[model samples]
Target: MPSLATTETLIASSGRKSFRVVFEGFLHLMLLACAVVSIITTVGIVLVLLIESLQFFRDVSVWEFLTGTKWSPLLKPQHFGILPLFCGTFLVAAGSALVAIPIGLGTAIFLSEYASPIVRDIVKPLLEVLAGIPSVVFGYLAVVFVSPIIKSLFASADLFNAANACIVVGFMILPTIVSLSEDVLRSVPRSLREAAYALGATKLDVTIGVVVPAAMSGIMASFLLAIARAVGETMAVTLAAGATPRLTLNPLESIQTMTAYIVQVSQGDTPAGTLEYRTIFAVGLTLFIFTLLLNVIAQWILSRVREKYE
Candidate 1:
């Protein structure tokens, strides 16, 4: 009963609405597919690690692997204790944390609270450029440059040592800490700053007392993630930290991390399905578990922070 023009308009509107609904459904399906792919990939990796690690543990008892201080799996008498690797890994991680946390946090605070926009824009990108450099390049840099400098300062330092690796890995993780912590610091409410200012608080006092506490959750999350990254690092650690798997705390001594051992075994020299080859998966699984725990903790902290802020 409507006029011809009115009927055509109605039809066009209905068609457009139908098209929008279909398009939205397609987008949702695409997103779901992407999520499923990621889940499947993670499951696949875990399954592979578990299967291979089971084979490894069949020969090397979990008790020995967890508590043993020696880690010479390929050498004569094949000691399979993983504690030395743990020590080496944590030595680099702790040293890197010491080097990175103060400097990275200070840089983030400066960028977020005080730097002019132009200085921030220029400096942040340059800092992030450090992140983009290849890990192998960092390894080479530690060997070729950092080691010599350390040796010059401390003649007792090994050519390949935990200290050299720690310095390089700290630089490697600096951008992550700076970027994430800066974002968190900037996200602190302007109202909070204003309130502190109203009470006669200086800018420094407001930042240290108010903004930092507000952003602590996110800052801690960044620190955990950076240390996790340091734990899982391979080439830089392997090349700079040497192949000696020893249970010593001296950063100047040559030592091997878990990831480094995996690398050493994963080279084409190790035959397929052998005990040496299986050690790779065992080490990989250990590294994976530790990194996963760190990530889980970071996520938990972030979630709590979000709930508080929201």
Candidate 2:
């Protein structure tokens, strides 16, 4: 029904629009490709760890690996006791959580409920800077600075020991917990706070009762993440927590975490393809599983809490 010129113009415009749509779709496909690549890479690493761990278990009985207390893979009689490492990891993680939970939660409360815009601007950057410090630097600080101070204080009090590493690790994870928890607290609906105020709730009461409960899921997830970081930390524990794998419950006694033991074996130059070399992968698998379980639990909690709030 249209003239040739009008029909040609309409065809050209439609072609251009179609081309634009295809180009946008291509960009989205590229983003999806990147996400797939990341997932594949993570899966590949887990597979490698699993395969090597299976080989180690083949040589060492599952019970021996799980129940053995001594972790001397290089010694004449190889022992692959995982309990000592578990003990060390739990001790450090527990200590870190004890130290971080209060301070981190307090900081979040201040940032979310108390701090003014100007104060927040200055404080948020400072908190981020603390997180930006390298783990190696934190390790050095624990070894050179914190350990000495802890030794002095504890020696004076007659309480000095390897527990100092736990304290230092706690401090190292403080920033992470604070930053994450604060973001979650800030995300709570303003209307909730307003409702509390209308009900004659004090600022403190509002923050503690309504806001904190609402953000509890995020706060808990942050705590779990902090524990994961503490468990996987290698250099800090290696330098500060001394490599003595004892089955003692005393935090003051020297202990070797799974990560620290891995670093020790790797740095000590265990020959490739030997049992000692394979032990690293085995230890790594344990650490990975521990952190993975924590992450899954954290995610589940967060999802349920978020759904309730939504």
Candidate 3:
């Protein structure tokens, strides 16, 4: 009993609605495909690392790799101990943490608690620009500039030393910590600051006692993540810290990190299927494990902090 015009209108509306549903379904499929691709890529990387590392372990004992102090895989009478690499890696990471944590946290505090809006807007971008600079540039800077400074300060320091790498890697990870910590500090609720003020607390007391504690979870997470980055950093460490795989803790001495060794072996001279070639995967797996553990710890801290704050 509907008129023709009304029938046409209804059909047209239904068609449009159907088309919209189809479009939305297509979009959802596309998003799902992207997510699946990411998961597949990650799984593929893990599988490759595991398969290659298993082959590597077959030739070299895991105990030796874990507990051994020497690591001269490519040289004559090759050694496969990974402890020196481990020590060197952690040395840079720890030193970098010392440089980054205090400066980064202080910068975050100044930005979040003290800087004017205009100053923050100007300074934050400049700070983040450090993150965008290539690792190779930092390496060059370390070699050309930082290493010389260290040599001047300490006559015993080598041109390629752990301290040089540490300083450069610290600068490399600084932006991440500062940016993340600042965001976390800013996310603390305004009500907390107001409450502190009402109780006769100074701005410093409120910032230190209330806002920082409230955001400590996020700040700690950022620290872990930045340290992970420093641990995994390759080029700068490679250039600044030479290929010496010594287990000593002296910052003035040359050293080699796991990532640096991987880079050394991956330069196409080592034949495929050889023990040396396979070492890269083994080192890669170790680096992956280190970063994964850091991420897991960061996540646990973040969740616990969030629960407390919320």
Error of 3 at 304 (Å): 4.0
How big is the positional error of residue 78 in model 2, measured in Å on the Cα after superposition?
2.1
Clashes of each: 0, 0, 0
Instruction: Please list the Cα RMSD from the true structure of every candidate, rounded to 1 decimal place.
Output: 1.9, 2.7, 1.3
- How far residue 186's Cα lies from its native spot in candidate 3, in Å, is 1.3
Measured with C-alpha atoms, the lDDT of residue 181 in candidate 3 is 96
The C-alpha lDDT values of all candidates are 0.93, 0.84, 0.94
Off by over 4 Å in 3: 307-310
TM-score: model 3 vs. ground truth: 0.97
**Model 2 agreement with the true structure over 106-220: per-residue lDDT tens digits:** 9989988899999999998998888878777777777677767776756642122357778778888999889999999999999999999999999989999999998888888
Give the per-residue lDDT digits (tens) of candidate 1, residues 1-310: 8999999999999999999999999999999999999999999999999999999899989999999988888889899998999899999999999999999999999999999999999999999898999999999999999999999999998999999999999999999999999999999988999999999999999999999989998899889989989998999999999999999999999999999988888778989999988988988899889888878878887777652554
Q: In model 1, which runs have C-alpha deviations exceeding 4 angstroms?
A: 299-310
Error of 1 at 183 (Å): 1.4
Please give each candidate's TM-score. 0.93, 0.89, 0.97
The residue pairs in collision within model 2 are none
- Name every residue pair that clashes in candidate 1: none
Model 1 compared with the native: what TM-score?
0.93
After best superposition, candidate 2 residue 305: deviation in angstroms? Answer: 4.7
**Clash count, candidate 1:** 0
